[model samples]
Target: MENTMVFEEPMTAEKCSGHLSSVEDAIYVIGGKWKLKIIIALHENGNIRFNELQRIVAGISARVLSNELKDLELNGFVKRVVHAEQMPVVVEYISTDYSRTLKPVIMALSEWGRKHKKNIREDLF
Candidate 1:
């Protein structure tokens, strides 16, 4: 099989290294188990309330979902808004283009998973 990425020798850092704060923050926002699925839900549907997002991604606890949404909002991947409705109000989650930017990453992961599944299935039979 052909390799997709070129490998290079390891690097050594100087006494001081550039801050990886933003990069680390981005990874932290999207690196969790359920964050990507949450983004996918928002991307597919323009906006959704808290309960709606919880429904969209089943098997996720309320606390976990809340944390993921907070992380997404902090990282600029999602925007949280208050609904202009009646007495009872709701908080909605919407994906920003920044979240949509994850399309290629998600697509690549899906393609890789599909290939792995196919190979495994073939091997089984």
Candidate 2:
């Protein structure tokens, strides 16, 4: 026996509306240029300090990085941990489990981006 699944066509207006709302919410959370870059850097480097993070993401100003980190923390995608008990007070940012959910999404986007770049290059020739 073989297992198969079928999808329905012609989505209802209600379903389409709901989907659009969901996509909007997602974009609002992670849409900007720096947000995903910050997230990706954090994921790759593990916990790191603010200055180090700025260095890793590259081209992002301290002001912009500070704002983005606050946004990510608020959205449950990143965690800011402070070691106040230590000398001079240490701080680090870590990617939350919620952020891990974006792994597949990042992978898919990377693949599509490579293909798109290649196609564009070929077209230019």
lDDT of 2 by residue, 38-104 (tens): 9999999999999999999889999999999999999999999999999999999999999999999
Error of 2 at 5 (Å): 16
| TM per candidate | 0.78, 0.90
Evaluate model 2: give its TM-score: 0.90
Candidate 2 local lDDT, residue 66:
97
For candidate 1, lDDT tens digit of each residue in 3-59? 565536443353114336665766766887998999999999888988888988999
Residue 59's lDDT in candidate 2? 97
Off by over 4 Å in 1: 7-26
The TM-score leader among the candidates is 2
The lowest-lDDT stretch of 10 consecutive residues in candidate 2 is 1-10
Whole-structure CA lDDT of model 1: 0.84
